[model samples]
Target: MRLRWPVALLVTLLVVVLGTLMGSRTPAEAAKKITIKDSMGRTVRVPCPPQRIVEVNGDVAELICALGDAGKIVGASSYTLQDKFFTSRLKKAQDVGKSFTPSVEKILALKPDVVFGYGKFLKPEIIAQLERAGVPVVLLDCYKIKTMAEDIRTLGVILNRQKEAAAYIAYFEKYRKLFADRVKKIPVNRRPRVYLEQYTDYTLSGPGSGGAELLDGVGARNIGAGLRVPYPKISPEWLLAQNPDVIIKACGSSITSGYGEKPDAMAKKRAEMMRRPGWSRIAAVRQGKVYMLSSEIFTGPRAIVGMAYMAKWLYPQLFKDVNPAAIHKEMLKKFHGLELKGAYVYP
Candidate 1:
């Protein structure tokens, strides 16, 4: 109590030091939390990189795995895993229900701190359910393959894995150039009169679809160009009138209009396309120009796989040197340590 001024100051410093030594937090605890925004404009803040995450988009799950981290995800929409798209990655995943009904109970049980989802398909009600419960939901859209590669960077920024994301985007860019070079060399006469088959039937992609865009990307001419939404129904007779040189079947979601699954079964469900019985004379069938593609590959980040397949299909001579199947196999090895399957046409 009777200490001199200098001594008092020294004592105060000692007390402050002692308190800091006893009460200071570890470096890990002091790190700043990250806040991310979903495409729908909701903000998600996490105290730390979470141990459990719920994903609504199948492609987002694939991209996360490609970024080398699927172990962080605990929940997914049921539809994604039902198909070949999730073949290798579904071992640790659990179904949360369809895109329309992601099980609140199931997701809640996982106790996910972060929910990563995509699409306008996820209703506002489901999103509200998550936000109301204080779960941070971040939406990432990768509907187009071109934009899909860009979205990896967005996810990277959120997950704090920027380098991995950049690496993936860079990889996709290389393929884009490979496609462009081949496209640039094709002459007008050699460009195939391409038909973009959206469904098993005569549903054709017109001027404005991912399939149509990809067809254009590889310098092929779409016979259905200038139509409204692309994949409008076309009559078999009308299709024969055009006499397309090549036909690329690009499947999309919603395969159940009572459609049976098989190349020949296509005639039953898509009766309008039956090139026989009441109607059977399309040049595509007679010439054997038809090819089947995966439904999932038609949209989402998986579209990259679709695009690679498209490039190879459009110009076998040009891309004969490049093996699309081999590229996918290599992607699986480096990205997910899983094998690629169901990404192409089945015999």
Candidate 2:
């Protein structure tokens, strides 16, 4: 079987090249991936159930943990990765940056297999940079209640947490349905015309906000819905005209950096600053329906909290009084093993 050396060498090289080409062409031979589109409608192919993933938002990071895959998250938002609830579960990972802006060099250095981020916070330029560095980024948006359930399902596909995600979605849907059915029992005359003051100044979290959506779901109407802006600038005159039955100041006017301020103190400060002659006559101010939104659950993973809050605010007798504080405690304990105390404030 011995042949000329030159001919034998040529034949061996051809065989090796043909075998490599065949392996590359075969799906079974190459690394298999499940193709899925991110929240932004960008096709991102995740390799093998995501051994290493980076999250740029607290909700996304928390979702990864709820999915029981903390080990896979290599990088997370500085705020979330440090949260006692999330950081205790994921000890090794640390601050990549804020959600909207992350250190490109640090992320590239990690060489992560997949990156999970929020649509509202993570910038498109950052996503582009990650792609340029040859990384896969999956953006998810769960900002509003309407699309929140769908967003959870999308996360399930990417993280392979479909079962847990489905269960959570089902739980929220069921809770909402039950709450709505109860609302239907209320006579039209008894339904409260509520004003949900999500914020002050330019950033009034409006009908599109989670709080307003919940109010609408439970039969209470939001006065801000007719304002005609995604987040309209509020004028004192409009408040006078609407004459809301109940005013829920879910949160105070906070610049992003100055969040978690007391609603009463903030209101007093605003009142002194703007001496609108008729402002004091508003029904909400007279009745003190204004309240603070004391938890992060209103938008993200705290659908249970939102339900509890709405139930208590709208129909206290029917709901046996939903305690947002207690619900926060249970969720933190079950999901992250942390105890919460007095997070929501009525004062």
Candidate 3:
């Protein structure tokens, strides 16, 4: 009670200092939590650099692994393991179930901080259950070519990997432009007529579809452009009448037996198409312009590879120097930290 003035002043300053210290937090502390808007237009509060995550979609899992956060994945869809690329990288992640029907029990047991899922495929009830259990799920739609860059960026933001996201976008756009810039110079009259066999024979990709978009990007005319549906079945008669200049059969993903293990699988598929009734009279069959295309490339971030190959097939004179296989190797090495070798597309 009889303390000196200096001592009293010192004690008051100590109290003020303690209060200020208690009120403030470091940048790291503030960065722990972040809110983001996913592709579904729903606001989600998630942990930045989430420690544990579950991936319901293989493509999303692949993208996350490519962004250098593979360690964060605690669980993944069962189909992810089927893809050689994902299987090699996501060896640590437990298979929860199919992407569209993930097991809620396994997911809850994993106690993931967040789950990356498909908005269109995953049932709404499952999403609701997860949210009710305090798990935040961010839905992403990567089906369209236009939304891929944005989807990658959104994922990057959520995971606090904006730099990686920007880098990926740059790489993706570079190849996309590599196709568009050269193809745009070709005269309209020279555009080749392309018939795309989608996931099966007779099933074709029409206008306003991912397959059609790839064909359009490479300055090729989709023979099914006039079809009423985005994806329609072309009768054998119709296909023969169209007489496309180039035909690319999409293999894998609903195709019969996934191109098989035979070394001549691609050749066999081509031969089968050529042997189809009335196909011998088709211009594509006669000129040997038919090729086998991987469905994975046309429907994923790797569509640039399909574009390159399609351009080469459609206009060999224009894309004589374009090498899609080399581009594929480069992309795998650069983004995926992988040296995957396979026949993605072939004659």
**Cα-based lDDT for every prediction:** 0.67, 0.67, 0.81
State model 2's lDDT: 0.67
Write candidate 2's Cα lDDT for 1-347 as tens digits: 86666978999999999887886442222445788876677777776566777888777777777767888777877877545456467787856887789988778777688788876568889988998887878877765667778888888876677898897788667666777878887877788887666656424546556667777777887776666565667776776787777665544224111122334554554454234567567666676655445445555777567667767776788888556667667666666555664334454
Misplaced by over 4 Å in model 3 are 1-31, 253-263
Residue 278 of model 1 has an lDDT of 28
Per-residue alpha-carbon lDDT of candidate 1 for residues 1-347, written as tens digits (9 for 90 to 100): 77577978999999999778757653223435686655555566763555677888777887877776677777888766665545566577778887666887788777776777764667778878987887767777766555666567778876678888888787777876678776887787878888777755678877655677677667888888867765588886777788777666654454421112344433233434434442335555566666666665555554556667777776777778787667767766776666654424532
**lDDT for model 3, on a 0 to 1 scale?**
0.81
| lDDT (Cα, tens digit) per residue for candidate 3, span 135-157 | 89999866556777999998998
Best-to-worst order by TM-score is 3, 2, 1
TM-score of 3: 0.83
User: Candidates' TM-scores?
Assistant: 0.74, 0.77, 0.83
Candidate 1: residue pairs that collide: 204-231, 205-231, 206-230, 275-279, 275-280, 276-279, 276-280
Query: Which candidate would rank higher by lDDT, 1 or 2?
Result: 2
Off by over 4 Å in 2: 1-31, 185-189, 199-202, 250-279, 321-326
